[model samples]
Target: MGGESRIHNFGAGPAVLPLEVVTEVAESLPNMNDSGFGLMEVSHRSPAFQEVIDSAMGRMRRLLSVPDDYEVLFLQGGASTQFYMTALNLLSNGGAADFLVTGIWAKKALAEANRIGDGAAAWDDSSNGFKSVPGDGDYSVRDDAEYLHYTSNNTLFGTQFNHLPDSNGKPRVVDASSDICGAHLDVSKHDLIYAGAQKNLGPSGVTVVILSPWAASRGKEGLPTMLDYQTHISKGSMFNTPNTYGIFVLDKVLSWVERNGGLDGAIRRNQKKSGLIYDMLDGSDFWRPHAEVGSRSMMNVTWRLADEGLEDVFLSEAMDSGMGGLKGHRSVGGIRASLYNGCPVESVEALASFMAEFESRHG
Candidate 1:
């Protein structure tokens, strides 16, 4: 897809990607690393695929400044898996874990933790419609809590934590599915970090799991083989036939990030892209932006048309204008522009222009 064929996409997951990376992926589909096996058809145990996974892990370490003692594994399942796996592996026997319930995903994580042992909400913004994350003093961890879990960015509500939440010195577990490489994160501070690759990293099916030294060895025995983090860690994230094609695309995406100034660069661009939309939303009462000022996400900017019934019209016209994926999640029925690392500045400028024209005609 190119020029008129391509579009300014704002989908949440499996979002837009850099044209360069997409092109490279298409090129590699036929032959990858000069090997006889293609990217999708390559055996997980083959040498060519080994290089792909290795490069992905190494890039993740370098991009995030992950501590040397930490173990990085590209595992199956999505952030949903980490919700249960983290508690099963790290939560002490008969112990509880605390959660900051900022959105639907965090609430799901807490629910998953409860299935294993006890998961309590240290702080929750559900009462306020998931508009903001909590400050350190707003919540207290349980005395018996083994770890504190939080989602770095909430895609559905367009909220994000500007600073790391206070965990009361407990190990930090995060579901960073939406804003992993595009946002600021201190890998050394978190005991466990997991992200679904579909958003900022790559296509779906590949989930990056980073565990600290303690986390790697903290699991209780007798866990299922595939669900066990150590099982994958011991085999270098290849405990079974992994997501071969997904990992290869991930490596290519990371390579694109590396050449384009790494995580810092991605952050800068994400900020710029979201800022373009936020500025428009703030400048006019014609639009109602979600996620209070300081808690707004740099990845997803969501808002509603003040004029009733203009959302459908706006989406319809935006599609006609070559802009796609502006529809918000069902829970928040409005417009949502997900400006992930892959979304370029030009698309945002186009969206901003569209918003201006829509307001002029309808306001």
Candidate 2:
């Protein structure tokens, strides 16, 4: 799949990775660091593997500018598991957490919290089909709430929070699974942030969690040894054998990000790539985007053609043109072009050219 014929991948998660990173991983697979053992075959506790995990976490801190008070954890179970873990750890004794339901993942996070204990939507936009973010007066925060939970980007709905919402001095927790390292964020403003590695980081088996010192202290006592964030933190994210190869790839990807000018460079490139598709959608009557103009996602550009039939034709033709993963999420049926940190300008331009030609032929 890393060969010259690789297609442009726009899948929402397990999305495209930097070609250079892929090549590096490919070369290391047969004999990593001249150890004569494939990365997958090595023991997680081995010194060589320990170096991989350590370098990965260190690079993550420097790239994201994580503070001294924060702890970075590499865990399994993806972002879904963190939904429950966040509530179990952060929601105070008999207190509720406020969730801002802007999209599918936020709703799922709220549901998971309710299943475990007390939680409520500070504001829910489900009634509006998640087409926009909340206006100034639309949502209110409770002073007594334990924390405010929100998803920074909605992969399915193709919407994103242009600005973090006000938590009214409460701890702000975010699920940034789809857009964590795609751009620079004010890490200090958030008490806890979690993201699955499949989208922008590395692969499916690893999840990255960044927790503030105060938040780490708030985890519920007597929890399972594995589910507890403190356990992983105290053990340096090796409480149990982690996804060694995934972390290895992640380290390489982070190194690529740093060498390519870090998060600032990623943001500029992402803006340019997504701009091509959004501009085409804006100028063409045949293609319509599902998201509101201001709330549109730079990571996943969701849009539709004139009708479902036309969308089918577009996807079929796009596949023939070497563009894959253009289908939309089931909940919101349309096209979603996920432009992650690794999606190159050339791929975006090719996709734009294809879109233009498709419109001219079928519009």
Per lDDT, the best of the predicted structures is 1
TM per prediction: 0.98, 0.98
Predicted candidate 1 versus true structure: per-residue lDDT over 43-81, tens digit per residue? 988888888888899999999999999999999888888
Candidate 2, residues 1-363, lDDT tens digits: the string is 537989998888798898999998998988887888897898888888988888999999999999988999999999999998998888765688899999989999998898666789988889889988775567888878888998888899888888878888899999999999995578999999999999999978999999998889987779888888889999999988899999999999999999998999999998999899999999967888899998888999998787668888889899999999999998899799999998888999999999999888887
Please give the TM-score that candidate 2 achieves against the real structure: 0.98
Off by over 4 Å in 2: none
State the number of backbone clashes in model 2: 0
Model 1 ranges with Cα > 4 A deviation: 1-4
Candidate 2 Cα deviation (angstroms), residue 360:
0.4
